[model samples]
Target: MNGHEQGNSRAAPSRLRIVVDTDMGVDDAAAVAWLLSQRERPVELAGVAAVWGNTGVDAAAVNVVALLRALGREQVPVVMGEAAPSSGPMSPIGSLVHGADGMWGRAAGTIATCPKDLVAFYRAVAAADTTLLALGPLTNLTRVAALAPDVLRRFARIVVLGGAWRHGSITPVSETNFWHDPEAADRVLAERLPIVLVTRDAHRAFALTHDDLAALATAGSPAARYLAAPMRAYAQVTGRFGEPLNFPDVVAAVLAVEPAAATVRRSALVRVVTGTHGLVRGQSVMGFADNERLAMIEGGAALARLVEQALAEPTLHLGRALAAILAREPDNAEVVLAVDAARVRRSFLCALTREART
Candidate 1:
């Protein structure tokens, strides 16, 4: 079932309206592209909010605009956010992973403007049923909860692409996103939002290999060229001893739109503890399950299908079945049309490689 069909079958009004909160890394960019292209949830993409993680919000905002423009989604308001928290050591940059200025080296000017307040911004956009697809650190979100608890109460759910039930990408215990902002994580989990935890334990189920990417690059599509730079970057940074880096986050976001299309296990409460001994700091713990287990299982073909559909469809406009995005985010129109056709061509090649393997 699609996200909405799985939620409730009785007289549904329309598709799920979602806002992506991301750090604008290559993986996050992939996730955003994938989510926006989905027909299942038919994400509205109210706005792209930046947080401090792979890159700071300022840089992230610029990168978001660039990627959106590349995808032909420039009108999507790329909102700048807190460069750093009110009081804390700034989070370290994953420049080696995302490049110096976030978009694999593309530079663009970001106007010095920001939302008057994030809590208010969220309140204005989110209804009682909006979903927040969070693909970065929880700093902005956590801050929203603290300043205006009621504003946060309106969100229907928060799907976090950070943390790990056991295995971690950054350190033995902590996932890089959570480790960067543990305080925010604590606040997020504490809030009563129905959290769909897409942890490392779950994300690892989907892997995009080098050979997989290389095949696409050889295909000579516009999307293939787009995927080349970041795919190479990802392989270089997160890899261990020549092994390719395992990227499950972007694929996880794709899976979220169609959970039925994926194999996912459920957990009652997923929490992180900041202070601890060696190899245990920032580790994610599940209360009920001894270890995280799959509640749902989607085959590799299902994921491949999701990617295939995204690549096939035009990212320039809202799906005919769902007009909410086009209606609400009218500003995104030019960016949608301005998408580099070549980049889209490359994306198709990447999907073709995935399709062939599947």
Candidate 2:
């Protein structure tokens, strides 16, 4: 969630040099495929990095390659990014939202493979303008910055899709990605670059309904067919059994290709609250700094349709589709409130920490 943002324009890029960092959950699969299929605004992969969330980076790396191959983008290198070891023991979160293998109790075998010299590939892109798409924790980016801060600075900007201001999906005020590694979050935000943040308050607004999934089941594109299974499986896992898969990682992908897809953005100064060890730990507190500022994308229905349209037509110029999708935006202005019980689960975490100390 820690990155930088630039101008909000719909003018498509001829090509984008990018480093995609992911936790490789179901929405992550969707985001990766969408990035590959972006027709007008093609994304050129510098590298794809996996972090330890949603799943371990080891498994995340495997899934990254699998999806890239599904879209016939197997040439992109997959890097198991460097991150400090977890400071505390915690149960894994991917299995709950994205199933055990990170896909439907998946019956199919993967045809993906990773290269051994991923770091070499990363160093090769040092001089170019790179945009980082963070679909998970900031650990990988922080680690990369330490190795070559200038290489990170060369990034034109970053488009991030996680975090929250007042409500915490992980704790009282922490979102999942930021909560998983607040130290990394703090470090990455400290770089002070222009960043576009799609936080939890805005992300949760893009919901999927039964109609959206129905469209995917019949869209007949390779992307549609490939992504439909896991999306449906995720719906079932989240007990939205018949509802649309509401994960919003794809929102970030669309914004990457077309920033105009989001109509509202508030610039705010921000800070990350670390080491509180209770409800406040890992929270990204906003409106605290005067000079440090980032644009927070607002949540709405245009986002939902943009995602659906992207799935329906993977290579469609999102800039063109925005006219129609943005028209339907008003209907999607308010998303039905859904409760995330993750905080309830973390409440028991304090007991474990106490036991560890005792």
Candidate 3:
């Protein structure tokens, strides 16, 4: 059922309005389709902004449109965002997991020719109580923060499907999203906006086996059908590595709509490694101690410069900012450290298979 048809009977006083910023990979498509299938719930898909990560900018937009059309959600607007990262060219590493087309070579639908103005669109959406669901690189959101910090602060919160605390998926110390654009990730974290970080530490607990795909195929909803091919393809690819499919984006989406699904959460200071150029680049330096150590190490030169500037000026603003950075006094983000895997999996399946209540 479409979003309008499913939630028509009841007055959803606490309906969540979400603007999804994605790169339209297989997992991203799964997340979007799952969100669309929540007909019985009070979640609204405000809009989708496609950025360059899992695919090219145009391809990402096309993929989102295709998924929406498959689920009878063509009414939702789709816009293209940044074509590449601010610091360098687009990375093709996502192709290994998502395939060359970003949707397991199954993306198909009419392309939307809407103008690509992510900042403007986001600004407009900010007028409402909206949560930004970021399922890809932080480039687009960082652009918004750079061009319009006031507008960026207007959103209720941002649910980021990135980062890794224990280990990384793409690299030893870096997650794919942050690895793709560490500069942008660093800038976003520095903004200290209300952010819910769904990292690898949490998503790794929610894995999807072949059995889940079989169940989804049997269920046969439009969302399920749309998800079947890509998920299966994803499983096949990861199977070679003796690993099950993990839906990081889907996990983040679930947490966004149902915050209670998260079993373990911690408020912490997070810093994306951007100053250094090595294996540690894009690493999510979490906690006060780690962040402080990282700053003292990789950022020693920058810190020295900051100290010099502060010493020269002795201004309250610079001194306070320096103190906050050095001490890591207040937590900036709420990190999702763990989730109820069984409950998340069950809820995901039910959303796909169960009929909307009248």
The model with the greatest TM-score is: 3
Q: Which candidate do you rate higher for lDDT, 2 or 3?
A: 3
- Give the better candidate number (1 or 2) by lDDT: 2
Better of 2 and 3 by TM-score: 3
User: Model 2 — which ten-residue stretch has the worst lDDT?
Assistant: 349-358
lDDT of 1 by residue, 1-358 (tens): 8998867876533776677887888778767756655344456777768877787778787777766766667777656665774346765657867777666765356442545367667877777667778888788888888788877668776677767756776787677777777667766776747676677665654556667667756754434455567777667766744644555456456544555433445545455666434465556655443212111122346545655776688673324422332232121000000112223333333343434353
Q: Which pairs clash in model 3? A: none
Worst 10 residues of 1 by lDDT: 329-338
Q: Could you give candidate 2's per-residue lDDT for residues 1-358 as a string of tens digits?
A: 2233345434555777777888888888877766665454676877787777777666677788777776677778787664333356433766787877676544246644555343464576544477777888877767766666766666676777666865567766778887887777777776665467777765655566555666666665666677788888788776644433456687776666666566556655455676647877778766422212212222345466666878898798766655443333122111111223232112111121211110
Ranking by lDDT: 3, 2, 1
Each prediction's TM-score against the native?
0.72, 0.71, 0.85
Question: Which residues of candidate 1, in runs, are more than 4 Å off?
Answer: 1-14, 39-41, 85-87, 107-116, 218-224, 275-278, 289-357
Q: How well is each residue in 115-227 modelled by candidate 3, as lDDT tens digits?
A: 68888888878744888899999999999998989887888889998888997887787888999999999789889899999988899888876777788887878888878
Worst 10-residue lDDT window for candidate 3 reads: 289-298
User: Cα deviation of 49 in candidate 3 (Å)?
Assistant: 0.4
